[model samples]
Target: MSNIQKIGNPARQSNNLLFKRRSILKTLSLAALLPVGLGAYPSGIVIAADGVPLPENVMTPDAALKRLLDGNKRYVSGKISVRDFNVNRAILAKGQNPYACILSCADSRVAPELCFDESRGDLFVTRLAGNYASLDILASLEYGTAVLKAPLIMVLGHTDCGAIKAGMKADKENVDFPGHIQTITSELKSAVKEGVKLPGNATDNVAKENVRLNVAKLKESTPILRQLVADKKLMVVGGLYHLDTGKVELLT
Candidate 1:
């Protein structure tokens, strides 16, 4: 899908839409049977296909992070709470009021919605080959917070990222990349330079550093973002997605 589709997406406007709604009693029974706490939805709240509700219950940054982690645990344990996207599509057709914005890599293996176990319309996501933040990406995130009032932003990186390796190899061999691919390579070189100074694998460490670098940039960003952070109205953090375990570890 295109980046626009990955973002809040076009309005889901269909008056005739309707689908199966899980009985509240049945949902309560299911919740009681599960050992782990399923992420919260407001009482009598309908969970549409986008597993998570559009207007998330997270008020604080910590709560938002906890909600995501809770979802990841369910994903890791193969106990994903039932989501009715068909119903979600109908409910979200009018407008979306998502709570958190995610800056994640374009790796096929790393899906923010699935990893966070959030349903559609719950997250505002911007993606590229590397999880680096460029001016355009930063501008979009600013809009997400400034206009949409999203309270949290997460820069999510991952293990064995191809973009990191490509940059590492390019830096080591002084290979010149063709076309616009050079843009991502150049952005990542600084992280590779810093990563090489660390104590672990080259690409792996650089990938983590990339998340930190971007998170720092967002935290210190000017105009909208900086003011929001200063007023404690918004938070920008970093995370590393563990592909094998399907868990996201907080980095900053």
Candidate 2:
């Protein structure tokens, strides 16, 4: 990579990046979304940021959830559909209209796009280890749901989360990292505390419980989100991503 390449035409640069990203994404087994030969989505389908079109049914929370669950079923069965990113790139370049929002972990292996078998632009996502409903995270969600009008929001946790493991160890050992790591550890530990009463492995139980905790927090969020929930315009739910099975087990 040269400095000339770094300052190249912005549009060309963006396209180059998108092309490279698609190349990488296509290689993943779970990145499979819709097969290219399916023709087009129904007349009710609309374009999203990722360039994939979402059916009108996905405009509603229940319908959106169903879409994701079905995709996961396809993923778990290893029956993935092929997608042509070259076409979708043109569609997505115009704009994005994602159907759902997900708060998930930062774990490298836990790619939500693959886990749910969603193409790009189909899901608006925010991630961090031990996915908590922090103030900044809520602000982003407010924009995604209120402005972007995504009907469903899912708080996703996963198995063998390093954040969860670290938080658990911190609780048992009272270890402290040098910087902001302690802060994130603290948030995860709180969820661990809540899940301690449940019977099971500490990290695994906390991972699921953390999702439940965030779901409740987001539902009660005021002004924008709460009102949307009240009007049935938005829904907040939770799930656990099983690493071994490549499945998202809905917690709520």
TM-score of each: 0.77, 0.77
Once superposed on the true structure, which residue ranges of model 1 sit more than 4 Å away at CA?
Answer: 1-55
Candidate 1 accuracy as TM-score: 0.77
Tens-digit lDDT string for candidate 2 (1-252): 643366565322322432344433532322233333323333444445343354443468898899889988999999876877776676665455688899999899888788778787788999987888775676688767765678999999998889988888788899997777887787777688887779877778988888888898788744567778999989899999899999899899
Tens-digit lDDT string for candidate 1 (138-178)? 66786666655678999999999999998998899998789
Clashing residue pairs in candidate 1, if any? 12-93, 48-84, 49-84, 49-85, 50-119, 50-120, 51-119, 52-119
In order, what lDDT does every prediction score? 0.75, 0.75
Candidate 1, residue 192: the lDDT equals 91
Give the number of colliding residue pairs in candidate 1. Answer: 8
Model 2 RMSD vs true structure:
13.1
Give stretches of model 2 more than 4 Å off: 1-58
